[model samples]
Target: MVLRAWPLEGIGEIRPGDDLAAIIVDHLTEPLEAGDVVVVTSKVVSKAAGLATAGDRDSLIDAETDRVVARRGQTRIVRTHSGLTLAAAGIDASNLEAGSVIPLPRDPDGAARDLRGRLEDLAGVRLGVIVSDTAGRAWRIGQTDIAIGASGVAPYLSFAGVEDAYGNLLAVTSPAIADEIAGTAELVAGKLDGQPVVVVRGLPAAWLDSDEGAAALIRDDDGDLFGLGARDAVLAAVSRGELPRGFPVADEGDDLLALARAGTDLSLADVTVAADGSLEVRALSEDGAPEAHVEAGALAERLRILARALRREIVIAVVSD
Candidate 1:
């Protein structure tokens, strides 16, 4: 696939009502092709969308965020107005007027669709458009540009039923093609540079006619197996301070086995099931110390992690002596 990205130089400060697509189109040396995908950073989109406002960065971040995911003193991972979980609600205080923070577009998907439609009408070519933004991964360092909005492109390529080179059936082989394209575009749209647009060509023919946008990238919450954990659920319940009418019993043995695997010195074989479905876990120290009572609630935390890792529900209870 041929991918090309260049800065739209000489274009000074993008104001609240700037026509970004026009600004980009007028600066391009070559015409956009039929199957080309145009990736634009959401920062510019947000600026044009009038989402930028003058305020303290933290205040703006707090206003835009719905919940905080992870916190480390001053750093925080928050779910933003766009339903995206990212750091600081994707707010940026740099590159704009002092005291002004650039927030993500109110509705990135709508912005992408509008831009794509307008570009197609103006350029007289069928093309895809993706609104890109940098986001951090769960277990990874550094950030990569991902598709927050998309038009005329399939967000993901599902290969679930396809066969590999070995002719083995692929069970879960979906690729987030939109995010991949966004990341590819970021290679040219450097963080420090003024480059805001990238053109990606030569994608597979099947993706050329797709109308699905980044909405396809959102995984169904119900379908997500590792959505919550025992600790998280219990903490949520504890915060409410009321037992749920019908909550699933988290499996404690599975958690114990996982913890043992994590060098906790316990195992499935070391656990026995009681009449009431509680689990009896036994552990012996290297020096042969007396067996200790491991709290079922405490053990539930370990099982919750295992359940999240396995992407399955587990039922567990601690055997009370």
Candidate 2:
């Protein structure tokens, strides 16, 4: 219940050959306890792991990525070598040379494990470790640090089947505690303040355990309901594109139009109504202009009201040219 954060400074001189855990321990006034979870930014880990290279930032981004999920001109969301979908493949240009970019550690979980082992040896206490990085969220503004790698800490706190105060069974109640802890720790590790390490104390003792790493926070691609489709995935494949697939597809008519509007661009003329009260839709411009011969169905009627209000009616004849 007691959460504490310690910001370690003067770490700019830390190089690839430097011992990061040793540096952090030297900066700490108090020894880390068995239950304390130390959150280290991935930037520092990458620096210590020699993940940086001299090359075109874009080229490095392309080299580190498995696929481009989404792109808006020069900006892209990519699935990186670490199996993480993030902006620019988590290639960082800040705090480094003009032509140099820092890629995330090849294995964040391994970084956390190694750090934990070193700390245990140096401090003589079994402790938890988390490697964190800043990431943006869908439909959210601002960025927060999340645990990309963890050791001796539970990634999530499950509350499934637990009853509420009213005795209602909780169906899904798992909380990404590791990520939450990382976010809390970031408040102390300022972005440009050279605070790469933070000591988190007063977390629940139960969270202290040696099990799987932060991999638990990652949802399986297939089992995820939010997993995007070929077209949608291609459109939004960048950065956590796998988690927004919730909510039923808009009911094949106006609802679909609404969803499209929220997720993509849509014009009123994209939909049409036929003489028989059926609804015909031309989802893509490649699908061609609305045809008069396409029949309108019951589902179309619900959407037609909105289409009509928007003057989306198409008057083209169904006859082939």
Candidate 3:
């Protein structure tokens, strides 16, 4: 199907406590039509929501982070409360007056719903809405915009169980349409330009007028392959004092020591294994929170043979404090 993204121009600088719904409604070159998608940059939403803070950017990142996903010298990729894995936890310094950084929306799905309701009231037609932010990707060189919030739109178009032209059944195929719309709109909504709103047309009929929010796009740890940072995984594993399962021990050609330090999500923690395959596993607290303790015996059997207990103590010791 054909697609088009038209930038909404002439929007002035958005400010704290501004009426974003009214501002967007007033600045539209034309009224929004049914089935149209309203894509907005989170910068303006943050501005209108008064989300800018005088707090230090790093401090803000720490506050916004729910978990540390990955980190380098000065760059940290964290999962925010919004379930977005982003550098600096989706805290952005761009497009604001000096000395302020803006965190992502506290409730992006709610924000999208509010915007959608207001726009429909003003334009007298139903429409979809998406709030977007820029983020770097895993194993990708550059950054692109992704949908952080959505309303009245289907976030994904699943091809699961559908057959392709070659007639192969599709078991696992779903495109994140909300993110696609957000990225597509960014093509014309220049980051340096004042444009923050854009209207996209020609979306598939299935994705129109849906009330699904962007949170649906998040995959839980059960499905997320890169759930832990290499450093964090290593720290957790070492703290337990035994090699965790899935430690890449079977990859004979790989460097086991470096792999251990890089990080992993050890199933067990607070346990140490001896050379003779003996074990000293930590006891669980009163509530039995350390569910991993049960796996200690299984993990010991794997590590004791490989390290021979003597050579294992002196290793790269990577990961974080």
Candidate 4:
């Protein structure tokens, strides 16, 4: 299947309460089709919704962040209230007047739905709308545009239960279609090009007319394997606070090499994998003194807590002198 995408030119600066649908319609160089998807940058949506504020950027980020996942000097990766894990809570500080920043639309899905309705009426054709936003991946460098809001577009395409070319059953091969479209559109909507809208055409007809929004792409903490960063996972396990997700029950032969890099003073000799998937841990000290035993017990308790958080079984023993 072939697809084509082009950014809408002549779109001027969007202001609060502007008719975004009309602006896009006016700037359309070609007619839209039923399967065409209109991708709008989240920054323009925020501006049209009057979400730009002249407040402290840090304060805005703090307010938008639900929890800090990781921090490196001045940068913080945080999860927002809307379940998006982003750097600086997806606040856009670029291309705006000094001291003014734009936060993502409070309800991107709803915004997309509303925009789709308006565009459909104006264009007289069925359409899909997506609100795109820049996001960084935990493991990958740099960023990409992803679908923060979507309407009339299938959020994901599941290939589960399908047979591959080699006749292998595909169990968990769902591709996030909305995000793919957003990223595809971003290729034409250059970052500094002032092009905030792109129209993607030639998607499968069935992919349109779907009600699933982009929110379906978000995996809650329980299901997300990387819910917490490596350092954050260790800190959460040590604090005995609400264990941030990510650590799952261990299976046999699961090499827990991550524990070795957890920034703890404990040696590899202290932790071992049992024959059955459970962990066997020796206390930190090997002295016969009562104080040493007490310290060992305390360390063992901490390991127990970490095990419980991970929902894995652990056998703890005190070291002998």
lDDT of 4 at 168: 100
- Quote model 2's TM-score: 0.72
Worst 10 residues of 3 by lDDT: 312-321
User: Alpha carbon lDDT of residue 48, candidate 2?
Assistant: 89
RMSD of each: 10.8, 9.1, 9.3, 9.4
lDDT of 3 by residue, 232-310 (tens): 4544454344323221212223343333323323543334434654444443334554454444333433344334322
Off by over 4 Å in 4: 243-321
Provide the clashing-pair count of each candidate structure: 6, 8, 8, 0
TM-score of model 4 vs. true structure: 0.78
Which consecutive 10 residues in model 4 have the weakest lDDT in total? Answer: 246-255
Using lDDT as the measure, which candidate wins? 4
TM-score of 3: 0.76
lDDT tens digits, residues 1-321, model 4? Answer: 999999998797899999999999999998887879999999999999999999988888877878877765466778888888888889888978888998999989999999999999999999999999998876678989999999999999999999999999999999999999999989988888999999999999879898889999999978988877665576566654565433122222223334432434443235555576555545444444455455445556666665554455656654453
- Ranking the candidates on TM-score from highest down gives 4, 3, 2, 1
Question: Cα lDDT for residue 231, model 2?
Answer: 34
> If scored against the real structure, what TM-score would every candidate get?
0.71, 0.72, 0.76, 0.78
RMSD of 3: 9.3
**Model 2 lDDT-worst window of ten:** 245-254
